[model samples]
Target: MDTPQRAGHVAVIGRPNVGKSTLTNALVGAKVSIVSPRPQTTRHRLLGIASFPQGQILLVDTPGLHRDQGKSTATAMHRWMNRAARGSLEGVDAAMLVVRAGQWDEADTFAYQALRQAKVPVVLVVNQVDRLKDKTALLPYLAQVSEGREFAAVHPVSALKRKGLEPLVNDVLALLPEQAPLYAEDEITDKSQRFLAGELVREQLMRQLGEELPYATTVEIERFVVDGALLRIGAVIWVERDGQKAIVIGKGGERLREIGAKARQQMEQLFGAKVFLETWVRVREGWSDDEAALRAFGYHD
Candidate 1:
């Protein structure tokens, strides 16, 4: 397919675990963002470019919007969400408000309210239809939202299953104004190699840690050096408390070793080079809420 000369930015904003990252990967036709079942898995604003037949769409996958309690990592993540949303929406040609199909709650309303306040041309993307056994049940909820609103269009899609995405892409491209491509044709994402490597480690850690540890942990790549055929990396995994650190390290450091091996393999595939990854766990007492620590770890306000 001939690449479309026209292009514009499209911001994907939604609440936690609503498949925002999944939809981003699907739309971009690449794994630009790490996907996990856990909420707030995305901590940074990731840019993924989708080159459609009609045009290239720069999809800015923002962190999920949520209320913060001024304590813990959740608050820091919420701040990141606000920062990404407020920063990226300016002068964008279009926006997609992604919400889970069957789970219409107060958080969805908050996301909608924020989008409405942005005053950008918005499209409501109802995602995760695969989870709904009775797909028709979503109609009433859809109708309730559609009434007296200025949504460019409402699209129900399954981001994970790759269903109903073509229409969404078409609608987003149609809304975009004619312009030059914002990024290079070969570029799939805007995050650095180190950032992607750290995220891959974090993704593996999230899966291993499950519900109890995913929210409390933050992975940072301390060192990355390429030596010919081998890529050497050092990363530190930060947890809120000493007990959590023990949990991550596991019995005789077996679990942490497993996590490192899995992440290194994935990093090798991502960089197309052999990887030597070294990871260690650290207990940073309330590091999530500490302004200096958060900033140092790349969680900017």
Candidate 2:
């Protein structure tokens, strides 16, 4: 007799910069979600489909759960991101409470509380274990976080290095009800190519820009056309002020060109086709806080 296939949704919940997107990409075997060192890099809830011989995991990658204080302002974007993270709990078969291996804070507690309220099985994922210098501390840290907490299982993994995922996957699969694969094995994510192209461009923005600029910026795909074996994409990088646009454009537009080049390379790799990506920076004057602007920029439900 063979084990039955299990398929279901798993909400990837965590605080900012805890490697949720990296874990989702590792599981799906593709870069379905964008990641940046900056908090709130993920503004929308996207699904990454990871298929295995025994089961399939539908990962809902969300923005990091953080309070509206500190470096992040209480803008409409922040509110939207928080809503997106919380809304992911609904209809999930299980939840992965992702946190740093050696650190647990109030934000992590807040995420755990949110998952508890969801009433679904929570698998505590202690991510970024590779970065821990003191390996002996791992046991104590794990014990500390797991104390008085209910977790179906706890696994330490390095999503970037693709370490310790097999056991984690097995444990998570066991929690799911037996069913057939929800998506085709070849399918990686629920987002379309157009949306991904915009995200790739935004990923470059998050990677290359300075501290505050990336947060103040958003990308929109104005054009996505398949020209034979190539994809021609036009992306508009929206900024909150004219000064920000000048900074993004940089000296002799070199900065914008570099951003486009890197984004196009990522697009080519992900799409497995040639990509011609053009980017332009435009000022929207406080678009981050304006509800109408956010909706127009494709930040709605």
Candidate 3:
């Protein structure tokens, strides 16, 4: 006799920069989401599907929940990010809250509120345990976080190191419904190659450029041409102002070139074909706040 098949949706939620995206990638066994050290790097609800012999896990990577200050001055982009992350929890079979060791603030607590309201099986994913200097220090923190709410299970993992992921995946799969696979066994991510290409370019910007500039920037793939085994891509890097555009292009165009090179390499690896990438910077002022512009940029729900 064999174990029954199980498949369902699992939304990965957490505060900003708490390793939610990293953990999702680890569990899915592929780079379904682009990562950056910056907060709110993920702009949408992206699905990373991991199919196993007995079960299939649909891991939804959402934007990190922004920390709420006493006063609500959260920008338009922040509002959108929060709405997206919170919205992903609805209708999901399960939810996982990724938090760092010994770091639980209002944001983590806030995440808990959303999960509790969703009335779904919630798993507490304590990520970045590798950062702990003393392993014994983990007990108190773990016990502390576990005090409130009934988590289906608690998993301590290091998303960056890819450690303790097997157990985590197994545990998450057990919570899924006993059903057939939702996606093909070989398919890892639901995002289109074109979207991933633009995301890769934005990732390069976040990794290579100044902190403030990356937030001001967004990548758009204006054209994608495929000819048999070769792919040609033309992308526009949008910034809010001329000074921001200048920062992205750098003094000698060296910065922009570096971004393009790395992003093109990522595109080639993902598409498994020769890729020709062209990137140019343009100013799109106040696009984040403009609903029409945001819709044009594919930020629609």
Candidate 4:
């Protein structure tokens, strides 16, 4: 008897900062998407592929679904994110809805609504279980979240600590159909190196800068040239205003230097090659709200 192989797509839907990206990375066993503490860190629709002996899962990590977004770029960004996440759910064999353990907000409700509207089979992933002091407290929370909806399985896992992930992956893989793998066995993601490098830079900047300032920043890879064991990458950090640029660059360009150094180190580790990274900050003047600018920066579906 031979082992049956299965494979299909799984859309990991959730509000911002619910560990969706982290879970995607953990399941794939690689850094396919960038992660940050800030909301709206994942701007694009990312695919992280996880392979198992019995099957494989192509996880779709979308921009966080936001609710009650107000005027300006923030609203535009949230709408676009919701669009990306909703679009990912279409045609996917299953959906994984990640919500923080013991908490549910309006944004989470928005995400859940999208999942329900999609009519796709859902796996409710209650991430951050490791943060809970009383493990039994999860029982009622799980029951509440699963109420009035059908879940293939309710997995309580910690994307950060890697706890309870093995079972979660097993359940998710089982949700996929019995078909051949969609991507290559060793291929972790379907994104270009340039896009990933840009994401990495954005991730580091978001982590280093923290709060409000990082939201105004977006990364564009201007150049990616490979020479033997050395990789030269030039990235432009786009900000909506001069003050934001100044903040990103920091005093006498110190913050910019640190961002570059940290990003370069990650790049080297990711690509396994010496990296020559050149970063420059520029003011894009409300580009986030500008639909044309957003599309040009690859923010669209």
lDDT of 1 by residue, 1-301 (tens): 7554678888898888889999999988878799888887888888898986677999988888776556544565566667776677776778898988877778887887777887888999999877888867888878987887779999999998999999888888888887777777788998889999999999988888867778788999999999999999999999999999899999999999999999988888778899999999998887766768888888774
**Per-prediction TM-score, please?**
0.92, 0.98, 0.97, 0.95
lDDT of 2 by residue, 94-152 (tens): 99999999999999999999999999999999999999999999999999999999999
Q: Which stretches of candidate 1 lie over 4 Å from their true place?
A: 1-4, 68-77
User: In candidate 4, which residue ranges exceed 4 Å CA deviation?
Assistant: 68-74
- Point out where model 3 deviates above 4 Å: 67-72
lDDT of 1 at 194: 93
Name model 2 segments beyond 4 Å from true.
68-73
Query: Which of 1 and 2 is the better model by TM-score?
Result: 2
* lDDT (tens digit, per residue) of candidate 4 on 199-232: 9999988899857888778899999999899999
For model 1, name the residue pairs that clash: none
Question: What would the TM-score be for candidate 4 when compared with the true structure?
Answer: 0.95
Q: What shift in Å separates residue 273 of candidate 4 from its native position after superposition?
A: 1.1
Q: List the candidate numbers ranked by TM-score, top first.
A: 2, 3, 4, 1
Q: What is the lDDT of residue 105 in candidate 4?
A: 79
Compose the digit string of candidate 3's lDDT tens values, residues 14-99. Answer: 98899988988887877879999988889989999977776998998999876644235665677778889988988899998999
- Point to the candidate with the largest lDDT: 2
lDDT of 1: 0.85
Best by TM-score: 2
Q: Root-mean-square deviation of each candidate, in angstroms?
A: 2.4, 1.6, 1.5, 1.6
Error of model 2, residue 112, in angstroms: 0.3
